[model samples]
Target: MGTNICVTFFAFLCLIALSNAQTQFLRWCVISEAEQKKCQDLKKVAASMYANRVPSYEVIPLIECVLGKDVYNCMEKIQDNDADIMALDTGQAYFGGRYYNMMPFLAEKYSPGGAGTGTGDGMNYYAVIVAKRGSQFNVFQLQDKRACFPGVGTAAGWLYPIGEFVKKNGQTNIMQVTECNAIVKTATNFFKSMCLPGALTSFYNPFGNNPARICELCSGFLEKKCSTDDPFAGYDGAFKCMSEDAGDVAFLRHDTVAQMAMNSSYMPDNYELLCPNGMRVPVTDYMTCNYGSIPANTVMTSSLKTKPEVDVYKNFLLKAAQWFGPSGQYRNQFDMFSSQPWGYFNRRNLLFTDSTQTLVDVGEKNTYYSWVDNDFYQIMEYHNACPLITARLCVISKQEKKKCEKMMMAFNAKDLRPSLDCIKGKGTDDCMKLISKGDADMVMLDPGDVYLAGKKYGLEPFVVEDYGNMNASVHVVAVARKRDHYMTLFNLKKKRACLPGIGRGDGWIIPMNIFIETEQFIPQHCTLFENLGQLFIHSCIPGAMDKDYNPNQKPVSLCEGCAAGGFRKCQRTSEDQYFSSSGAFRCLTEKGGDIAFVKHLTVRGNTDGRRQSYWARNRRSDDYELMCKDGRRTHIDDWENCHLGQIPASAMVTAKYKSEQDRTIFWQLLNYGQQFFSSDIEGDFHLFDSGTWYNDLIFSDDAVRLMRLDKSMQDYRNYLGQDFINKVENLHKYTCVPVKPSKKSSSSHTSISLLLLAAIFILQLVV
Candidate 1:
């Protein structure tokens, strides 16, 4: 027996020695057999391309696994401590809950050694609270309160949630530290144990019998009927339960259904639509979001240097998940989708989750803040606990991921563009194409990036008009939110102030001091003047945009302007009121009024006043007033329905009076040469639609000089101040009238020379 023992001991010692000196073994930590097989396959690929560096770039894929067999063994031998660079997450939505946002923050903060400052991987996660079946606390109630998290090391479980908590506190000035502890170790472990392999699952397994058990722990009680919301929230609970029994709640969960349900449903559609002339139509998919926007597209950290490197790193990240189990299951099944759901996996993938709730809750201090803000700032602040990326836009692509890397690699290499791109899908696809060509000037674009990219490259972004949400954009154009803001700070050579014409509306809206200062809004100003008379005609067009206007008016005859849109009756005085009118001035149509500004009409036998400005001789009587048809006179019945005697809804009035009448009455006063006024245009308000506040309306420099408003400018100083208006005055007063478009002085000599040349050519051909 003694001799056998000695032999066994000696053999064991040899085995121990063998384990210590081997150089080829990789410290892999896969827990499952399937995962182990995957790791084995990865090993073969690694050997074939170990430390492989592609042309024009240098990148290596590093992978390892942690096996529970020996907790410390896997970490014992890290082949390279931190020689090169590394990226932890794929930055895909599939893993966004664990990466994106926090990664950037960590990267921005850390300024790591060889990687320089801000080098590290990223992580994404939900701020979850795994509570018991029944607890008495709602999410909002827990604000600034203590909470538990999985761990702080990874971006998913710890950093993002902590950051969210800080963002909620309004300022990072005094956020309390979170108390995260291991489930198996802390009192909170009760919630963890329920979801573990033990008891068929917990009251909160999301699939268990009494879901209230889990909800109570996290949300206090479950009202049976749908009170309003839930992550997977219902109307309400069958009943409430005690607090301590409340297990936990995953406040900011993974790609889990519970975490995403609220955000997806919180907002309805985004646009207020209308058909031309107030026509009725079904408008879905109009605008589906506001105070909301799509998440970031792509991001990069110090993880890779070239596009290929980024691709490789992303692939490695996929491989990392191979250890979880069957691509779905895990040692902890509750966390399964923390890796899959669509919101976490969309192309522009999100960076954080709990931040969504944070945004909504902190509305008091920071209205309109998005989960994106905290996400971006976290990446900026952290620099990188590991290695992070710096992306001009929040979204990034692995393919071009390494492009930034290459830039950093060559000291002399220059970047004429930013490392990011963003875009908005507004109106038509043709507009999207404009982004590539740099046409639209989006106000939402990050000015920092605009300056960087604009200065780098010789490119610029210009404005294009035609579409925008009417509520905001009335003037100049806006660009793709993702496009660079090259010109915002560069001071556009202010175009000369344009005089208010038939095209410029009610002058401009008086300064919008009431609704303009809340958020970081873009200059939604416009330059393409919507004619003043046109605005009235356009807005009052019956049946056009009726659904959009939902106007409240009792249609009275003013023959002046529509009564909706804050255009109610003005009280000029008690004696001279239409709807109890109060003005000394009564609106009247010049002989040029009611013209077919949009169409031309012919003389088809009119014995009425019959001169100019009238067309469609139908229903018009010889004694009725006349109006212009495209600046030419035409006979017509009274323009106001009151005078025309209200034609039957079933009958076309034009046909009743005269068979050929298709004329519709649209009125306007003629304001051709009025200084600071248009007979065609009413109201002395500044135009906000085109952001021409004091600059263009009332007085163009040329108009002022011609009207001599320049000397008179002082007279109108109280009304038209000199701020941005000076640029308008200087340009317009001195600017030359557009050179006449007529053909240059005709050259009879040139014509004769041409004829001679023709003759010579003919002779040459004959020869």
Candidate 2:
């Protein structure tokens, strides 16, 4: 007897040890033969999958699975089990209320929720309504009317339906709004916030007495043949509001048949039980045990004190409600987003909105989706980089030892000038010295850098001839059109305006500042501001200089006849039926004689010892503004004072063109120029590149003619005709643009460049 007692005590000790091990398990019950193998192979004693409950919601069993174990991370093991059980369609047997009812009977002696209940066939797993038009309501304007909810549970219940109704009305209290975009946005938020989880995919497309997959298009309400169930099975809401498939439905989720008919804004919709073929039989509703008790969901809930939890965070009930929400966008859309390995992210590519959401930053910019539709996990692997890892213009210029800036207004790349700052002509000397020295933050270059970079772009010219015939004339001229070139020029105009990339080139440009105000096509159309130059000099001294017409006095005959006062009736062009603002007016009429419409005059304040003016022997020399001797600016409008000492025509063309600097300036105009000097010195008024009576604006006809001469516009020098060439006036700004010598760039030693230019100037001065 003593020996038997000792043996019994030893056996009892083993049993107690086993019980303790099971009870002291940690949270998270996982069930997977493969993972289980891995756990065992990895000598992991903590991880275990409980076979007791279908949904693994039996908290105690789940806790016992990992009791006293010491391992980190088991969610993956658990979710994979869910996929297994869910795929078997036995999820209801474990997660449903029937599973709860049978919990106490698992061991036949008040078992705490196990698979001992052979009664439940998973009917109450997740009951949903399948109506063509589900609880139709667009949530019209709020009226002072209490909602009516039918009490008492039906086969299709009421809480989820009623909850949806109340939730939709909740926004009415915030503000008044009406519009498809607003309505849809509001509806989506409401769905995510209040709707339950459920599936409604392909609800509009019926197949095999159910649905094949989720329907995105070709769906409608109010048609029995169109509506099915299971749309919300997956987290794919890419088709929300897809052609109004869910325009009229308000789905609902119910806990049980008894609660389905309960009246509340948050109840399900249960109609009379159907007899056969879904035919309603009011009397049969009370006859049979067709209305079975719903299985309790295996869900865990914690108290949310300060704030209520989102619907997705709630138990199975919310999941059910999602499928029946107004949009039915909830079902497949809500796939337990909060339960992901990494936390959620919005369009901004940020982590949590607040600390309450709970998250940790992982990889940052190094992570990016190669494509737009990259996986959510991939994005989480490395946080979505909405701002993206782009080449910062300033940073690139600094790092590469080269000036790099996209056009400020457009994404066009800047053409960097060769460095002049490079000491000893070293290869691409350190350009971003400021950054290296910690003087600048080294951000992206100004978006307009591309535009302004034109200042550095060398005006390289091409030589070509004989493109085509125009106006009964065979012309020989160089022309150029490289699209990118024109677009770059256009982009410069837009950047000058401080606008975003204009739509012209393949890609668009934006400033690094994130300002997106763009003038579409403005970057392209701005090309109209190209250099055309002055056609004639209006300050030709009328009928030669005489004592009567002094340099300091206005030409009385010329003024009275045509060059007189301000208001003069003239046409923008002879072809133009009427006149326009002197600005942008294309003068095409009477060729070089357009300036004769009114007396064009100029004035010089003579601020410096030297003041330049245009006049024959008959005009006043002291005029500063375009005022007549009577003291009034004239109507000719096109007039200017020479800031530098004035030179008549280039009788000295060859002479002035001798020096390299002079040649550089002269060739730019000569090759693809629109400005030239006059044979007669007294006629020395300047003209703008293109515009006005005195200026030469390229007319549509002239442009077309020019285009005809340059099939590709690849060489602009070959495009201009004798007419366009000979009409250029020396006064035109284009006639003397300083050529940016290719060999010199700003990155070079600034001190040396200044000295070089200064030395030349000093020598000239001394001479």
Candidate 3:
């Protein structure tokens, strides 16, 4: 028994020694010799970053997993768990994801023209067909032509040209056909000869056994050279093919020729673009002349990893990227892309994106169809086209869902560039929340709500509604009867004032901000809203239903002057006497309140015998006047120089994740609808709401054109004034706090009330 125990202990010690001897490193898969070399440098930098603690990038141990000779083998190693991760062009990423059970966890971000910052949509570059400047050939005359391609499945170099051909043929909206076999057959038959490195061994290859015609235009020798295994296979190889005059046309990524031209070995002026429209442009005009862009290179992993393991890998890669990217001091030592030695950067981006903050989860499918922009999806699916595309619009409104459906119908009826879909939400806030949660796409927002949606909900404004004037800002003014005793901003402090609503820009938010800024009301001294309520005495500010808007709820102050529930009180709609611009003006005329906070032109438009509304039909222009900042009163026409600061026009906001292509398409559709419908004012179909139909659906009728807002969410705060933004944010925080008593407090108060009732009963009996 003792001898047996000794033998088992000795065996355990041997196993421990064996485990210690085998070195376990985080394997990074590499496809080529150059990539293998980069892996070494990556290992060194990662070691340094891992050791340092200041800006820790440490997550996974570093090692090279170069067990494969090519991208296909590299992916195979990943699938078998022999390797961990690798970066591939978007096309190869799709291929790996489709057949090899791989998933993408990161995408490369590139700055075009070496700009300071890159846009999310700038991830992809253009693909072009370059030919000699004096060549007489155009896209139409390319039949039976000798062609040179960078690689078999390369996006900009190969798929783009083939996709363009398929687009011209008009096939499917399904994105990519499995293995690209159908298009490869078409290309082999169309071209008299071609040199597409890796094409012979690729899964998509059509002429597998026919070696003569397939390799006729190839440059390398024997079985070892002239294919993807050769060093000069990508942009460099295609350019070599062009220079040697081996092929009449070469398909390459945009700026490749220009970048090579910077080396003096190639002349930029010797080449031109062969456009799909049968027009030719200079090589420098690649932006307008080249084939549409392909998706950017993506970092992918094999399905061997579980969900949690994949997440850990993603986190590690993203951290490594931050430590070695453009923002890091180690950029001189490492890069995230292969644009090195081309005046772009010295090191290549091996495992991370160029500028994206984080990797988006394209999910387990990772297919080409998962790419946003259905137009591109369809084009790539059916005809293999790479034209610019748009996303489906997600509208946010329950009451206006039908109107949105109608708008969708109208948009589809005309076959507009982008289509619209309606997503129902209870209210504006709910809609903004839906956008934040990625359920809804976009909605038109007032200035105050724009602030809330942008700062509080992480939404961004894509379009600002225009009201004919180039200046999209409006004037907020204080209006009152000329005979009223209120002569200045200070004089109306304790007076009963009429405002549009609690959350509105012109009515309540803007006015309250002015009061706070001018020292009329100090938020710090107020208990809930008692200070403001006391200052205003018994003022009427419509839509102040919640305690957050009016904490002194028991006083029945703001609601006192409000019309009955059915007739409208401080609502934004026309039914309320103390609602919008016109409604606030009517509040003063009807003696509901003394002063009205509204837009500069509200009183002017409602009075002077030009008014058409039932309440303003008999009103005269001289009765109402504007209150100037300098304790002076002026006529409504002179409100230009005597009003609150400028207010931004209502804007359309969407989630930041919405692609640029989709935003452009949405803007185009809306702009087209506005222009087409506004042209025929009497037409049954109107883009905006009328007296009783489609009221406040999408945008206000006062808006003319939809303008793009250049300001970001932070920039919006600056545009709206930082002090005002801070106050509004503070107010929102205060309002969001539950004002109702806690359970304990309620119970204690209930017990005291019961005691008082018993005491009252006893006193009555004794009496």
TM-score of each: 0.20, 0.18, 0.44
Native-structure RMSD, model 1: 30.9
lDDT pick, better of 1 and 3:
3
lDDT tens digits, residue span 566-678, model 3:
63544444335455556667778888777889877667666766444567778887887888777788878887778876687777877765667556555656765665455
Error of 3 at 184 (Å): 29
RMSD of each: 30.9, 30.2, 28.7
Count of clashes in candidate 1 = 146
572-613 per-residue lDDT for model 2 (tens digits): 111221121111111112121222111121111111222221
State which candidate, 2 or 3, has the greater TM-score: 3
Best by lDDT: 3
lDDT of 1 by residue, 43-147 (tens): 444433332212223233434443321111111221122211211222121122222111211111111111101112211222222222233444333432333
Order the candidate numbers by lDDT, best to worst: 3, 1, 2
In model 3, what is the error at residue 415, expressed in angstroms? 3.5
lDDT score of residue 14 within candidate 3: 38
